[model samples]
Target: MSEGFEKCHNEYTLFTKTSKEGKILIVNLYVDDLIFTDNDEFMFLEFKNSMVRELDMNDMGRMRYFLGVEVLQRYDGIYISKIKYALEIL
Candidate 1:
């Protein structure tokens, strides 16, 4: 393994809850970054607390930018659009 991977550490918390009794959900995490979706809000908070204790985390209060993608959330859903990203190619 590369030296970087050897020192890899978990640095984020994520929780997902479903309104129904049982549902399937997927969560993806990379280093200090995480992404997930669910109808349950409490599940997200519970996951956050567990992550904080283990990783000494800081909740940024919602994601503004992720992996060069800008996120704008509305009551309907999340909108991810890249601004000025196309110009950088030139």
Candidate 2:
């Protein structure tokens, strides 16, 4: 949470340490789950390790689904949708 990154007033938003060389890391917390992304791989790993050290939680690896939303990671970028939820509702 606020241990490593700067906490946003909006409750669950966190941003990595400011640095021109390091990519900014963004983290959003939803109850027990955390969704995080960074432009730099090293920065991401550093943040992840910090989280692990600060909080007792499992690293679920790459996010594929969360709260019924399907997360698809591609070379271009990430795509998120609730197609499965929509189908289920249908």
C-alpha lDDT score of every prediction, in listed order: 0.58, 0.79
TM-score of 1: 0.62
Q: What is the lDDT of residue 88 in candidate 2?
A: 98
Which clashing pairs does model 2 show?
none
- lDDT string for model 1 (1-90, tens) is 211112214633433334356643335567766565545566566655766777867777767778778898888998998775655666
**Superposed Cα RMSD, model 2:** 2.4
- Global CA lDDT of candidate 1, please? 0.58
**Candidate 1, which ten residues in sequence have the lowest lDDT sum?**
1-10
TM-score of 2: 0.78
Candidate 2 per-residue C-alpha lDDT over 58-84 given as tens digits, one digit per residue, 9 for 90 to 100: 988899998899999988999999999
